[model samples]
Each structure stands twice: as C-alpha cells, then as structure tokens.
Target: MTLFGGLAGVAGAAAAVRGTSSRRISPYDLLLMTAGTHKLARLMSKDAITSPLRMPFTRYRETGGPGEVMEDVRSEGSLRHAIGELVSCPFCLAVWAATAFSIGFLFAPRFTRVAASALTAIAGADYLQLLYAQLQQSAEGTS
Candidate 1:
C-alpha cells in the first residue's frame, strides 16, 4: 500500500511539475469525485464482473449483496495477499480511486469531470434502485 501511494504521489508530483498545477476544487466537482470514487471502488472491489481481475489473488467465497461478490484473499505471499486485501475491499481501493481521479483532474479536467459525473449518476441510480426495491417489499408486506 505504501508503494502504491508513493507511486501515485510521484505521478501527481510529475504532473504538477509539468505545469498542471493544482487547481481549486469546486464543491460540485468535489461531490462528483466523492461519488465517483465510491462507485468506482465498489465496482472494482465487489462487482461480480470484475472478479476476474482479482481472481489471481483472491478466492471466490460467495455472492455478496446485490451485484457484488464476496472474496477471500489468498494467503500465499505477502505482496499478493496485500494486493488481494486491497482489491477485495472497497474502503481500501477508495484511496486509489480517489488518487486516480485527482491525477486525471490534473491531466484532463474536462474528461475527468465527465467520467466522474457519469459515475456519480450511476451511484445515485443504484441508491434509487435499492430504495425502489425496499418500497416494493414494504408494499408487498402491507398487501
């Protein structure tokens, strides 16, 4: 994790040195990035479709909530296990997701904002879907 953070820091520093200095973050952009980071981290860490990417370092445990999957880290090697822990955890991967979006903002703000907006919309939609499902369940119970 330290290595990963160090590499991300180096990339950000290099980008800043190349004249893409840090820009003031707007509240809108901050919200978008937060939602984007959450969704992207969940997508990478828990989504069933992304399990293949984590397969090398993790073992499938069971189906997780909704479209997510539960995975256990392979305990063979330290580095591989560490990576497994990161890949299998949304909270852990959120740091990487946030850092990547930050770097993307430095390199290409417009594209980054667009991508973040899309992710935010998806996150919102996911919440709405869950709410809708809950309402349906409630209605059924009442009926």
Candidate 2:
C-alpha cells in the first residue's frame, strides 16, 4: 500500500506539472479529472477535502435572488437531480464509480492496494493536467 501510494503521488505530481505546462486540458475534462482525483484521495485518506470534488454539478447552482430562493427550496431536490445527472453522465460517473470501486477493492485483504493507489494517482495526474491547461487558456485569453 505504501509503495502504491508513493507511485500514485509521483505520477500525479508529474502529470500535474506536465498538464500545467502544456496547456491542453478542456474545462469539462478538467472537472472530471479533478472529481476523480478528489474521490480517489478521499477513499485513500478518508478525509473531508473530497466533498467538494464529488459533486461538480452542484457548483453551477445560482446563489441569489429568485434562483437562490428556488435553490434553497430545491436544495434536496437539486441534490437528487445532481445525483441522477452524475449517474447518467458517462465521463463524470465513470471516474466517480472507478474511484469508489478501487477503494473498495483496495480494502479487501487479498486485493492489490498498491496498484489501485497507482491507478488513482494516474487519474489524478491526468485531471491536474487538464486543470492546468484550462487555467492556462483562460489566462492567455484574458491577457
């Protein structure tokens, strides 16, 4: 498990560096990758930071005015809506499910935790790269 974790960390760091430097990731792709990484991290660390990453669609909700009121009324409803959408969205759900499954498999005594950890790390790296590219493009366009 330790070896796997190390490999994952290294891979994730490498991918993040490359992605940030290359500037090739799209917004949607970045979101998916971030979501996956967060999920993976949460599974491995049993931490709270992954909460925000798990539900990307919720971030789109309006925060004020009638929209806010509507959001408030429908907050639970929105969660359900988001879950349904997440389950249906191939790209988003794939990573979400993969991370969950990997975590589960890793905990089984006989399963290979290191490989799972490494896989999550690779996913995280890809996501970081995507995020980097998106940020780079946005920065360039604004400049």
Candidate 3:
C-alpha cells in the first residue's frame, strides 16, 4: 500500500503545483488527451522493446498471428511488485500522461502538438489496420 500511497502523494503534489499555474482543461481537449494517452500507454507497455520490462509480471502467450505476444498481468498486493500495473493499464496512466501533456501544451505547445498529433495519427492507423484485417478475413471466408 505504501507504493500506491506514495504514487498518489506524488501525483497530488504535482497536481497541486500544476493547479497553481495550469488553466482549466476543456472537455474536447480532455478527449484528445485521453486518446493520446491510451495510445502512448499501449505503445509504451506492449511494444517489442518495452515489453521486457513488464513481461516478468505477466503471462506470455504468442499473439498467434506472428512473433507477437501478449502480457496478462498477475496482480497481487506485493509492495515490491513490477510497474506492470501502471504500464499495462492505460486507464491507470492516462491522467498522468494527460497532465504531463497539458503542461507540455502550456510550456511547449509546438513539441506537444507534434508528439500528440503523431500519437493520435498512429492510433487512427491502428484502428484502420485492424478494420482492414477483419475485412480481409471476411472476404477470404466468403470466397
């Protein structure tokens, strides 16, 4: 519980500081930040290079299509547990990512926009790719 409490305390402190200088986040912008954070977490947690960090805490199974694999986190109350909890769950990290991005927008709008735009574009591409694959499979079945 100390780990979680510590994280919360840090987050609260960051928020308190941010509140002093940050403007109110609009709903529309919040939506964008949500999407970007979702993509960022997915990429960060599951990518080939990064998965190794969280894989120890998860079950490894081949994705069945290629050399890809999936990680299913095994949760426990162990205080020394891995960062899989934070990295594996987009919901867990979204607020932090959004806050950082919001601050980025405040101080470095150009870089933040470029990075967020890239993440958003990659997210769209991911959806389109998945849709295309499903369509192809359906067509193959019909043929």
Top TM-score hit: 1
Off by more than 4 A, model 2: 1-111
Give the 10-residue window scoring lowest on summed lDDT in candidate 3: 60-69
Question: Top model by lDDT, which number?
Answer: 1
Candidate 3 segments exceeding 4 Å error: 1-31, 55-68, 72-79
lDDT by residue (tens digit), candidate 1, 41-141: 99999999999999999999999999999999999999899899999999999998998888888888899999999999999999999999999999999
Clashes of each: 0, 0, 0
Question: Could you tell me which residue pairs clash in candidate 3?
Answer: none
Off by over 4 Å in 1: none
Scored by lDDT, model 3 comes in at 0.67
TM-score of every candidate: 0.93, 0.28, 0.67
lDDT of each: 0.92, 0.46, 0.67
